[model samples]
Target: MPPPPQKEPPRSFTARWAALKNIPPFLVMVWRAAPHLTIATMVLRAIGAFVPVAILWIAKLILDEVVRLAALPDTPDGLAGWWHSGLADHLITLVALELGIGIASDIIGRLLRLVDSLLQERLVIDLSMRLMDHAAALDLEDFEDAGFQDKLERARRQAAGRMSLMGTIFEQLQDSLTIATLGAGLIVYNPWLILILLVGLIPAFLAEAHFNARSYNLDFRRTAERRETDYLRQTAASAETAKEIKIFDLHRFLSGRYLDLSRKFYAEARRIAQARAAWGALFSALGSLAYYAAYAWIVVQTLTGDLSIGDLTFLAGSFMRVKGIIERLLSSFGSTAAQALYLEDLFDFFREVPEIASRPDAIPVPRPIRQGFVFENVGFRYPNTEKWAVRGLSFTLHAGETLALVGENGAGKTTLVKLLARLYDPDEGRILLDGRDLRDYDLDDLRAAIGVIFQDFVRYAMTAADNIAVGRIEAREDRGRIEAAAHSALADQVIARLPAGYDQMVGKRFVQGVDLSGGEWQKLAIARAYMRDAQVLILDEPTAALDARSEFEVFQRFRELMAGRTAVLISHRFSSVRMADRILVLHLGRIEAQGTHVELLDQPGRYRELFELQAAGYR
Candidate 1:
């Protein structure tokens, strides 16, 4: 939108390389790649260098003969020899050799151009894989961090820029070699000209370096804004917001906000480009002066008898080629600096390295739990939040106990369950398994001990069998066991009625697939959770989508399903929860009351009032 942001290339040395701290590592990568590029370029440059020196000597030999040709007598032999040296016939042979040098330079250019492409391809592939591996090792909490996510996104986008930097490095190396060869040729003709050319390059290089730093600073400052723009675009396009957006008719409202920010981003980009162009125009004028003066000096020396005709020809022809190589070398150096700036973001990402990297201390996860877990004064608040979601919370589920947790929205019921499942650790107190702190147990062991079904369960867009089998991904989770789980969750009825049965895809977004109704999806989710023969189980509003018939059957078989295991159940519906051995009505971040359902009904506190209200809803 709005022509995507303008990304014009650097115009001056300052604009290109002002951001670079050091060029050593970039030079290292280029140097490593030099063996292939340099071999071809060095061979061509040697030819160019030798030809010019030969032409200069030939010009000295022919100069005196040309000056006296008019006064010589007209003998036939004298005329034939005069036509050769008197007409600068040797000079013409020099021109042909210079032309051959031009051909060689072009050949070398094409060779580096082709080989650099293949090397960049391989380097980028290896770096991308490494970036992914590093990112995957970070802590899960870091992915949610705004700063970390922004850096990761910027690093990912800079993949092309990194290759561009490497290419610039290779190009600069080749140009530097050409300059060295040409400079040597210039010294042979007139040492004074070489000194003057070197003196003129300082201002141009400094200016270009300054501009590069400025551009890098600008890109760094815009990282946060770019991430914000991306967030807005995702909100506009994602499936998560589609239903609400359509209902509110907000497409235009959202689209205008996106366009406004995009225009602002572009405006700043164009401003930076304009400043760079003005700086480049100044240097372009200065470099042109050097071009003109060098030629003028060479011609003046030839007219005054200080330089021979062949020397004059060699100086004039080689000056432009030499100056052009020097300019290109400086420009590529600046480009490498800017590229290194972008690469700094990648290095910053590595500093955070993921927490998921394996530790040598991690023993194998015990396959099953022998004794159930205990929660002792567990308290938790997610990082950076002021309010605790659950505090002074303590509970225990010995082997074969089903403890129901009943609470309103945000009542810490779900928080308690997550702690029990070890998705998070308690802030103040420790949870234990048979007197051992849970942290002493392997993370994999703790997770494998429980099977969980969240209130917002995933409806996987896969075949029914595959979806259920995803729960126990370690083993070849049996098809027959999957079918048995479906029967236990009362989802077998829905499977029998499907057109393709167990093979049916669960989402209608694809060809030849049928999406299920709300209750059917719930049954599938419950069956998925039941796939693991885990020692502990958690069902948080597991029947929220089920019909009355399915709900009754699930709760009816609740004991057998939870047999020889520990469980914590969460529900707003009192009827389903009333079957538990004990009930806890949580209020705010603490347990308000706890008792058998009958005892709570007699007490007529929060639990009794809530249960009565649920009963009234049926009437």
Candidate 2:
């Protein structure tokens, strides 16, 4: 709930340049994504770039010929005379060439767009895949951090939208080529004209770059605000929260919250946009002024007999085209530079390496967990917090024994389970598995040996069988195993009553989905642990929602089902806790007492008080 972390300062020149450097690699990524389509798009664009210049030149020639024909006196004949004069032949050829170039340009344009779209689509899929893979590899702590969530949100946007950058680069290149060819023609007439046009564009280009950077900075500063806006919108409208929203009459509250955040974002956007528009209009006038100045000079030269009508038309046409291309090139360059800053987010997320990675030469977890787990003065506090969630916790779970942890709410029971599973390494002390440092074992192999189901387990909107199969996802298709696990967890009876049996959808997120009662959902979730077939099983209050009778039945079979495996059961229900071989009482992150239920009752400590308190409620 803390405020979002501040973004880094506006990119320095070195950082901006580094961002620009990523463009080449991004282009390389695009090429690798769809090499054939990329090459084809570029080849077509290269062909189309010069088509405009060719057409313009041909039009000039046709105009000059028509003027010459008009000057000649008419022959004795009428229409036939004009056709037979041989002057018409050259005119006809020029017209035909212009028409052909125009047609070819249209065709090439469409083909180029088609190829670009295809390339963009492929790159989107490729980039999204890489994003998901990289995110999956990140540590759990990263996902829990708000700053990292903001980065992920930004990266997701880039994944969906940044593929168009490839097309932008190609278009910029094509426009530059067009400008070069047209400028060559104008330079022959008057090099000063080309220089004037270039000068006119400099102000506009600089203004655009400045505004683009401002916009980028604005967006960077508002990452937290944007995420809040998204969350508010989702809460107001999403299926998951809709029931509560209606029950609490929270529609207006959520709507007001959403509007507040959106208005701030809109105000900031409006300010930046208005400034950009004002500067854009002013700079655009400069370019227009420069163009007209060149126009007057061309007309003066024509009137003084220094230039022909044909030369005047061609020079003016080339100058206009050159001016437009320069404008487009500069605008695209600014846009590309701004987009490169966004690329920093995408690349930065990739640059983050997990701090909890295993050592290169780490050993694998013991197959049977011989000596079980040992916590040697372990202590941990989450990142960015002062208080330890669990501190000075030293305990051992003997192999093949079932240990129960009893504690009040917020006693750090869940934190202990997470530590045991290596979801987090201790900040202060080391944990050992079979006497080897837990960090010394292969991370994946070590996790695969443990199965944990927490109280807030997800109820996936999937088939009933798929829900349970999540525990051992690799064996999801094994029907016999799925049923066996389900039966062991007392969920098979609930599934059997479903309309489609094992294939029945279990949550209301999708159509035709059936919502289950609290106890029934807990049964499906508990089945996951049975499916995992792991050496260590930790049930962290997964049975909390079950009825008392159901709870008694589950615990009655718990020991029999988990005969040889090491187990840890964390629950508030003393009936369940007392059934364990031994009980450890946790209070404020430290074990206040440890012994069997009978021994703890005799000690007259925190455990006895808590037990008597629960017993009084029943009496």
RMSD of each: 7.5, 2.7
Residue pairs that clash (backbone atoms under 3 angstroms), model 2 = none
Output the number of the TM-score-best candidate.
2
lDDT of 2 at 425: 86
Q: Model 1: which ten-residue window has the lowest total lDDT?
A: 1-10
- Pick out the ten consecutive residues of candidate 2 with the lowest summed lDDT: 9-18
**TM-score of each model, paired residue for residue:** 0.74, 0.93
Any runs in candidate 1 off by more than 4 Å, and if so which? 1-125, 159-161, 187-205, 238-240, 299-322, 353-365, 448-450, 456-535, 543-561, 575-583, 595-599
What does candidate 1 score on TM?
Answer: 0.74
The TM-score of candidate 2 is: 0.93
